[model samples]
Every structure is written in C-alpha cells, then in structure tokens.
Target: MKRTTVIGFLGSTLDASKQDAARWNKWRPTVGLCMQPDLRVDRLVLLHGRQHEGLAKFVTQDIASVSPETAVEPHTINFDDAWDFEEVYTELLDFAERFEFEPETEDYLVHITTGTHVAQICLFLLTEARFIPGKLLQTQPKRGKPDAGGVWTVIDLDLSRYDSIAKRFAEGSRTSTSFLKGGIETRNAAFNAMIDEIEQVATRSSAPLLLMGPTGAGKSLLARRIYELKAEQHRLSGAFVEVNCATLKGDNAMSALFGHRKGAFTGAVAERAGLLRSADKGMLFLDEIGELGLDEQAMILRAVEDKRFLPVGSDKEVESDFQLIAGTNRDLVRAVAGGSFREDLFARLNLWTFNLPGLAERREDIEPNLDFELKRFAAAEDTRVTFNKEARARYLSFATSAEARWDGNFRDLSASITRMATLSPDGRIDRPAVEAEIVRLGNLWAVEPEQGTDALAEVLNADAIARIDPFDRKQLSEVIVACRRNPSLSATGRELFSVSRQQRTSTNDADRLRKYLARFDLTWSDVS
Candidate 1:
C-alpha cells in the first residue's frame, strides 16, 4: 500500500489548548485525525500563519507523542484576513503549486475539518481540480466519546469511479440529445452524432453557434428547437427572434437589424426595436446569414462580441444580451476568400459550428421523418391521417429510391406527406393516392432538355440517316436527345412524352420511348 499524506490548515482555536497532559481529554481534530484506528497517516502537512509558529510546533509534538511513526511538516502560509476568500484561496493555491505530489508513491488526502470555511472551500476546489491530486479527508468528532479518536471519511471527486452516478449522467445526456433533435427518432448516424454534440454545446455554453447546411435541410427548425429547449430549461426569458438575412437589403437592412430612431431615414417612421433587441436575454437565429452585406456583417460581429451596437441614426450604443445562432446554406469559407463575407465575423461564429446533412444524404431517416410529419399535420389540422399498409410501403419504397431526388430535402418530404394526408379519403390513404403522388412528384422534378449533342448523328451512319423520312428521323432524334439528358429510361420517357402524357389517364412514357427507339433500330444504351 502507498503511504498516506494529509494536508490541512492548523486550527488556531481547535488545535490550540493548554500545553499540558490534562489537554489529552479534549478532542483536537488535527490530532484526532492521525489517531484514527483504520486510517494510517504517514505524513501530515499542516498550513499555518507566521504568528502560529509556536502553536504549530506544540501540535506537531502532540501528534508525534501518540503516533511516533507519523511525520509532521509545517508550512508557513499567511493570509492578511483568513475570512477573505480571494486572499485565502490565492495563498492556498500557491502552496498547492509549490508542493511536490507523487500519486503513484503516496496517497494524498486534503483535510477539510480544520480550517476557515473559505480555506476549506479553496482546498476542496484545488483537490477537485486535481491540482493537489488527492481525495478529501473529512473528520468529525465521535459522538458521546470525547477522548476517542474522530471518525474519518474520504471523498473522491473522480465521478467515473461511482457507477450509479455515471449511469445517471449518461442517461441525462441521451435525453438532452433526443430533445435537441425535436424528439424525432432520427436514424442517420452522422446526424445523430451531430445532434449529440450540439446538445452539449447548447446546454453548457452561451456562445454563438453556426449551423451550415443546404436549403430545406432543417437548419431553421433545429434553431427553433434549440431556442425552445433552452426556454424550457429556463435559460432564456425573452422571445426567440428569427430573420432571413436574404430578405434584408440596403437601408432597410440596417433599420431592421439594429432598430431605427424616430427620424432615421426615408420613411422617418416611429422608433423600431430590431430583431436583436427583441431577442434580448433569449436567442436570435439569423437564417441565410451569408446573404448579409459586408457592412451588416461588420455590425453583427460587433453585436455578437460586445453585445452592444448603435441603432440607425442613433449616437449612443444599445445593449441586447442575446445568444446568436447563425444558419447558412452558402459556402462561407469561399465567400470569405472572395471578399463577400467578413473573416472576423466568420471566426466569431465558427466557434461552435455544426453541419446538418440534407434529407437525400439521410434517406434512412425518411421513414421516421415521414411519420413525424403525419403526426404534425394531424395535430395542426385536428384530423388524424394515416396510410394503409400497401400505400405506406409503396410511398416509402419510392421515397428511399434513387429516382426521388429530394433536392428540396425535408421540405419536399413534408409537402408530399401533407398533400397525401389532405387527399386521403376518410383519413386513410390508399394505393391510388400513392401512385398519383409519385406521378405528381415525377412531373414536378422533370426539366426541359438542355441544348447539346445530336443523338441521331452519334448512333447512325450517314446512309442510314438518309434512308429515314425527315419527320420520323426528327422525332427519333428528339427522343434520343431526351434519353441522353435523363438519368433513367423512365425519366427520359417523362421528358419526351411530357406533352402527350397529360392526355392519357395511365401512360407509360418508358414503353412509348422504347417503341420509338425500336423504329430507329436504336436502344437507350446506343445514344445515352
């Protein structure tokens, strides 16, 4: 076993008594600490003032008389006022820094039973921080036994050593992470990990956070959720103010963000309390922050760093202590390099940046988000809507397929669900609704062919092209061009048969295109 060392202050009143054999009956805490039956204190480091040098020597002798094997070392630490927390803490900190600690060779314990309350608190802090590398040794006078040694208990600040407490903390962390995700059981591993980190930063820090992602990637929703979570925790009092930086421009931008005086500019309207001021003691989410002008960016940087800014046409600075959460789909680093964005402002907001992936990137989570959207619609519209087994399966299959571009991300998914839910007969969606939605989504995603290659020239020789009639050749050429432009045969057919497709109730664009290709002795692989 490693030798034990106990460090504590010399109790002026408790330790000091008549220097005689009769004093043995009175329980001196410092002396009683060494005399504990179970605890074997190898060395005692007693801290005292220069004025208590004689008393220190007497206590050392008293401890030595009973425990001859224990070594007592006195350290002369002086505080002008023992009750002054700063002075006492500083002196104790200096002693802790100067002392040599060897955890492998010696077990160190900080004795908190014999010192000013402030001094004890400082010692506990130092020990907890591992500056002294020790556990806390607290000794109390044994009840109904004045002459007997005190009972001692050791408190280790390393929380991981306690299984129950560590498990509780882990559970709380998971709950907080789930709350940050808006209680959505998101299945994307990368997204879940990002949410976990965001949860920690959101709860522990008041610093500005930067959320970067593509449009409709749920950046605004996440920002609102963060505000709500903080509000629920009682960390924020004022309302959550959100603004799209893309909408603010020119003189109006300044007046909108920083508030305007009664006679600020062209409008000369009444005084306005800007989004920042309105968000005082709360959160301000600046969505599409990359759209703000350089001047606005500079002003925002000042407000973020100093929490004070001059409003439009105002000389004095107004304070708005608000936490900032900036959202952007733009590549800010490139913007900074291109001189469109301020680097200093980027640095300020970059402290806690999180990139949320688009819905396409997290296709596995689409099912859960689909369920969440349906529930949301039901709650908002006051009518429950659900998909039949076949309809739900078909929708999910199409949703997770590569053909579903989902370029608009979560917004597209939410809209699709909302449309189907509204169209559902008696709150139950069936196969017809799913098929109609698929066709609608397909039409919505299709785009006109771009000007490029002549597919007929690439596939057929000069003589073969000459044998065909101009009309048939021209139609075949158009079909081939669409095939080359689109990703799949179905997509190509959709583009080629777009005009004629609306006339037929059940049209197969892919089959139509295949027959047209066969007439020209060509396949999709030939031109595309």
Candidate 2:
C-alpha cells in the first residue's frame, strides 16, 4: 500500500506548550494530525531551527506517544531570520533537495500549521510550483473549543478548478504572448495556440526546443522572447548566446561553438571560450542550424546529450548545462536523408519543433503587422508618422493582393514601411507616397520575362518599350533598380553616381533624378 508522508517545520511555541492536568485534554496541531482516522501518516519529516531544538524534541516525543505506528525524523535547517523571504525560502529549498523521497510508494503532505507565516507561504509556493511534490494540509482550531482537536483540510492549488481564475490565466497568457512578440497583436487562432504552448514549454522545461521557419519569419525574435520569458521567471541565470551557424565556416565553426586552447591553431593566440560556454545555465540560439557541417553536428549532439565537450586543441573537456533553441530555414529531414545533417541530432531537437508560416501563408495577418511595423519605425526614428485614410486602405489592399508576393516576409514589410515613413513629406503618408511604395515593391520583386528583361516592360506600354534602344533600356533598368531599392530620390542618386555627386558642386542629385525620370515621361510613382 502507498503510505502517506508528512513534512513540516516544528512550531516552537504552539506545539511545545504543555497543558495543566485540569486542561490536559487540549489538542495540538502536530498531535491532532496523528489522531485523524482517515489520514495515516506513515512517516513525518520535521524541520526545526537551533532555537527550537528543545521544542522539536518534545513535539517528536509527543507525536511518538500519540501515534506509535508513525516514524519521526528530525532535520535541522537553521534560518537567520524567519521573516526574511530569501533566507527562509533558500533553507527550505535546500532541505527539500536533501530529503529523500520515494514517490512510488509514498504520498506526501506539507503541513502548514507549524512555523512562521512566512515559512508557511514559502512551503505553499514550493508545493504549488512542484518543487516539493506534495499536497498541503493545514489544521484550523474549532471555534470556542480549544480542548477539542482542530479540523484538518487539504488545500487544492490547482487553478483549473476555478473558472474565473482560469479565464484570468488565459487573459494573462495572451498578454504575455503579445509582450513577447514585441507588442504585435496576433489574431490567428492556430498561431496564438502555438505561442501559448511555447510559453508553457519555455517555463516548465529545459529541453532543447527547435524553431523551424523560412528566413525573416521571426525565428530569431521568437527564440529571444523565449529566453526573455525564462529569465523573467528566474529559470535561467546566464546570458543568451546567439550564433548563426551559416556564418561560421571550417575550423572557425568548431572553435566558435567549442572553446579552443591557446596554440590550438596556427595563430597560437590566447585561449577562447566559445558560444556553448558563454551560454552556461542560460539559452543558446543556433540560427540556420542546417548549415552546420556533419562533424560539428556530432559535437553539438554530444554537448546537448552530456553537457560536456572537448574544445579544439585541448584534451580536457568543459561542461555547460544550457538550454538549446535552434532555428533552421531548411527542411532538416531532407538534409538528414541526403546525409548532410545527422539523423540522431535531428531526433534530439525534433521533440519540440514548431514551423512558423511565411507571410504569404498568413495574409490575413498583414494588416496588423503593417501597423506594427509603422509603430516600430516611429519608435526607432523618434518621429511619429501616420498614413492618410485613403492611403492606408490602398496600401492594405495592394499588400493583401496576390500580386504582392511577400517573399521576404516580415523583413520585407519592415523595409517597405521604413521607406514610406522616411520619405513622407509631413507626418502623414499621402496617396502618392503609398502609390510610390507599391510601385517600388513591384519593381524590387518583379520577375522579368526572357523576351523583355527591362524596366520599360513593367510600367510602360509596348510601343514605348519597342522605341527604347538597347543601351538606353539597360541604363533605365539600372536606374529603376537603384530607385526601387532606395527610399529617397537623393539616396538613389547618391548610389547611382557616387563619384559624380561628390565632385559636381553645382549638381543636385534629386534634380538629376527628376530630369532623368522626365525624359521617359515618368514620375517618381512610375519607377519607385
């Protein structure tokens, strides 16, 4: 049979007092606990401070006399001040760690009837957090009956039981998810559900989490948010170390991930602690993980499995107990099939893989994200910019249309907004500005046909395209490409004529661009 076990701090004053012969029939909490009929406490672990040594001994003896079947063990966990939250919590946490627990055969109870109110709170917190796997039992004195035993009731801290509390938690989770996404309001039910699950896993587990998505799909942002959330909960203590595996190459890849000893390479410089050591007790975000070589992948698997790795040019091994969140834009399963990436490594990180959809897949989200980007631009540039009502509608309509291929996802949206905000004549983005932005995006992402690989094919009539000479068409295409990529006329001109703009004292780059556009009967809206 599974036996019930009780753990509590000894009450120095309440459980220690001896009653007179006339009032000897009085009931104490510790003594009353043993007297319960239904509750059979097989063993009791009582924690006491040095000042309460005598009281603890008396309480144990009294418990023994009351319930001879129950085994009592006294543990000394001294606290400098019972009222200090940190000191009391630390001591109790240490005690919980040191105490042996047999969960298979023994059920646990934390008696909150004894010790200071602070200690009781700490025990409740720990129990609720599952740091101490037990239920809480508190004894309350019966009204106007001190001689009679108090009633004991089990406290259930499960939030699911309360509807209102559960709703509050849901609301709080939504708020937390919003905060993590940099205040971007997410309306997609599926995406929101994914974020909720991510938050739960981030707080409750330290296992390797994998975020899979296309480039500019916010994988890095989400990884950083997970780190921030863990740090806020005090679950992680070290710095967040991020590395783009694609940027690391050859010997440098190994040296970057695992520290190298001095004289490990040709340079023979000072020893270096790599990204893994830098992420000890924290989080490591390895973006573009599929780009790592097979040998490096093997080393990463070992580090994740054993928390130990041998740095380059060193016989000794170093350890770092870090939580991993790897980001990849590639289909890792295909890479594994092709033998480019290790299957074992894939299996290890596949436990919590999340696929983030590209912008084209979530077009319904573009409207809000557009506003989010504008707000971000305002904050970054320290200038407020708003679009006119008509301009906003026009832009949103074009953005949500099939012609608008958001190939770069959020990054594309961000760059587009930055351009419009920077070029807005006043605080407001007008219709012309919106039109210019649309044309710019079209030009930048436009795919030229094999027959007519020129700027004239996009915005001009066939007659105009036919009239343009090959050399002039090439020049116009170059000008249009530069203008599409740049935010302002001056910026585009500066890029097109870097040396000429520097030497010509009387020349105006913006005027030069305007005259060039005029030659083809084009305006800024035509080529932007």
Candidate 3:
C-alpha cells in the first residue's frame, strides 16, 4: 500500500489560535488534514516563509499531538510577494524540481487550502504538467461550523477519467478535423486520418510544418486552411502572409523575405517590412520553397531558429515571431543531395513533414470533392450549378478511372468542374457537356503521349517497342525527352541522375548514360 503524503503551505492566519489548553477545541486546516480518519496522511511537507517559522512550528506540534503517526517536515520557501504570480510560481517550480518524488511508493496530494491563490494556480499547473505527480486536495470547513475539522475533496486533472469531459473533447476533435478538411466529408480513410493529425499539430504547436506534394496537390490551400484554423482558435493575431519563393530572385529575394533598409539596393526608395515581418504573430506560407536561392535559404534558417535576421544592407538585426509552413512540389531531399538546397534548412523543416498525396492516389474521394467543387463554384460565380444523374455518373466514372491522369490533381478537378458549370445552359450539366469535357481532357492528355511516341519511334522499331514493359516504356520515353533536349550524353545524364550522382564519390555521367542505353540494347549514338 502506498503511503499518503500531503504537501501544502503553512496557513499563518487560519492555523493560528490562543497558545492555551483550549486551543485543541479550534479546528486548524493543517491539523484537520492529518486528523481525517479515512484519508490517512502518513507524511506532511509544510511550506512556509522564514517569518512564519514560529507559526509553522506551532502547527507542526499541534498536528503531531492529534496524529502522532504522521511525520511533519517543514520547508522554508520565501516569496518576494505572495501575490506576485511570476515570483510565487518560479519559487514553487524550483521546489517541485528539487523535490524527490516517490510516486510509486507514496501518493502525493497538494493541499490547496493553505496557499495564496497564485501559489494554488501554479501548483495546479505543475500538477497538470506532471512536474509534480499528484492530485489536488481542496478542503472546506464543515457547514455552519468554522472550528470543525473540514470535509476534503480530491480533484483529478486527467480529463479522460471524466466521461462527460472526454465526450466533449472527442466532439471537439471531430469538429476541428472537419474544419481542417474544409468540411468536405472526405471519404479516404488515410486522408481523413492525416487531416485529424494535422488539426492536432496545428493547434498544439507553433513549429514549422513542411507540406510536400506534386503541383496543384493542394499544398497552398492546406497551408492557408491551417492559418485560418489557427486564427479561429485565437492562436495567432497577425495576418497570414504568403509568397511564392520562385518569384523572388537575386537581391529581390533577400529584400522581399528579410525586409530592407532605405538605400539597401537600387529599388530601395523606402524601407520595406518583408513577408516575414508582415507575418509576425501569425503564419508565413512559402510556396515553392525549394526554388529559393542558397543565400536566402541560409538567412531563412537563421530566422527560423533564432527569430532574428539582418535585413538587406543593414547591420542591425530585426526579429519576427512567425510560424512557417513551407510548400514544395520539388523533391527537397534530392535537391539537398544535389547541393542545390541547404541541408540544414531541409533538416529544420523536415521535423514536422507531411506528404500530401495526389488526386490519382485518392480516387475514392472524387465524388464528395466533386460536390465541394460545385459548391465553391456556386458561391464564387453567384450561380448555382448541378450535374444531372447521368452526367454526374459519367464524370465520376472517368474521374475515378485509370484513364484519367489528373496530372494537376485538385486544380485539374476544380478547373474541369468550372468549365462544365460555365457551359451548362440551365444550370444543369447533361451527358453532352460531360462527353465534350471528357474529349477535351483526352486531347490535353494526348499531347504528352504524342511527344513520347515520336521520341521512341526515332530510336527503336515497332517490334522493339512492343517488347518493352509499359512502366519502362513510359520512363524511357521521359528519359529520351531529356536526352533530346540536352546536347550530349554527360549533360543528359546530369539532368537525369542529379540526385543519385551526389551519393557517389566519382560521378561518371557519360559512363552511366552509356550503360542505361546498353540495357535497352542500344548505344547513346543510336538515340542521340
């Protein structure tokens, strides 16, 4: 059985009475705590100031006379001002840190009846944070009897222990998850689970988040949604600032991100507070973060870690406390390996990395997302649009089928919906509209295959092409495109094996290309 240990401040006024034989008749909280028959306190750790030493001794002796089995240990904890929350909290925190907690062998209770309100709040925080492993012990005087030993109640901070509170929390989690998904009622289990985790992380942490996916896979939209969610929760106060790093070039990149002093460069007519500064106390979404220059990447790393960076042509450093959400379609790990991107910056952003899948990967969710797209279109255009049963069936069948490449992911879906909606005569999309849209998409997708087929025909015969695996044919077609664009085998190899070359001590681009051509029963000369 674990022994019960009570820790509390010595109540100078409440525990004080006449030092006479009649003093035993009055009830003191510290004495009353030990006097409880059901809640046996084997140890009492009394916290008090130096001036209250005499009162502490008196209370200790009084508690001992009644409960001789309880061992009383007095600790002198001085507070500059008992009501000063910071001072009191720091003092108590230090005490909690220094104290040896035997949680397994002894049950600890923080007696909230004796301390100042500030101290009580600090104790509650410490207990909730698990700095002090204990429950709160609150005491009240017996009804209409000021001098009587009070009734005690133990309050547990763990919310999961309370069914009602736990249910409310569960409901709140569902609401937050829904909000993150833009209330789409997404059908994909993996996507829904990812959104749930993103919701939790968005609300709980201010750390930088990395959203990586292919183009138009909703990285930018998701980053904005995160900002909006955090704003709704009052976690951020400033405006959401977004910038495409691909658009920022040369000296403009530095001035655009870290701000610039007057006369910083040729375009410096006035001092500019850049996107990072503009996003203070809020979030900064850097779309296409992999496109940023190495110099800018270095500055971003410093700003992210220290929240302080020197502006362009400025000696002084400025601070901006902004959360970062970096979005990229490019493979940053590959970029880092290729020496195009800073490894340290990648390391910092990789801490909370989440890879969002493309539309092709989440085909099951197309139906619900179709409805969401139509709703968005209705709101944006101020005109309602609906697909007839046959049209909806035709569109979904194509959208979710293997024939649809969906190269641009959600953007492609949104655009397809917008086009169909605009073409609908009486706000009703019919089979004709769906068939026309399908033909248009098919023509768009055909452009790539036509190019690939032309390239492959130049190198191999129809029989040779038929022998190649479909997967290898597609990949080889892309390789042939790269080879034709470049002038030589070495240049083409560098473009294709940019990431893999970094792993080797000796990079033989020409030799590697020659071998790959050999696998296809051809020479570089045959293709080039």
Of the candidates shown, which would achieve the greatest TM-score relative to the real structure? 3
lDDT score for candidate 3 against the true structure: 0.88
How do all the candidates rank in terms of TM-score, highest first? 3, 1, 2
Q: Give each model's whole-structure lDDT.
A: 0.87, 0.84, 0.88
- Tens-digit lDDT string for candidate 1 (1-528): 899999999999988899777788888889989898789999999999999999999999989988998999999988899999999888888888999998999999999988889999999999988889999998877788577376889999999999999999899888888877767899988889899889888888999999998789899989998898889889999899999999999988998999988987878679998888999999999999999999999999999999999999999899999999999986687678767899999999999999888776788999999999999999999999999999999999999886787757899899999999999859998999999999988987675334222446557767889999888877777676555435578978886678999999999988887887888787777765
List model 3 lDDT by residue over 463-523, tens digit each: 9999999999988888886665455788789878899999999999988888888899977
- The residue pairs that clash in candidate 2, if any, are 440-528
Clashing pairs in 3: none
lDDT of 2 at 56: 75
Q: What is the C-alpha lDDT profile of model 2 across 1-528, one tens digit per residue?
A: 999899988877667665454323666788778877778889988888888888777777777876888998888888778899999999888878877878888989999998999999999999998888888999866778465356789876787888999999989787777867777777777777888888888878999999987688899999999999889889999999999999999999999999899999997599999999999999999999999999999999999999999999999999999999999977677678767899999999999999887786677888889889888888898999999999999998999876677767789898999999999858899899999999999988775423235445555666887798889888787787666545568877776778877777776888888999899898877776
Per-model TM-score versus the true fold: 0.76, 0.68, 0.85
- Candidate 1: stretches off by over 4 Å: 1-3, 9-23, 42-61, 67-105, 114-126, 230-239, 260-273, 447-528
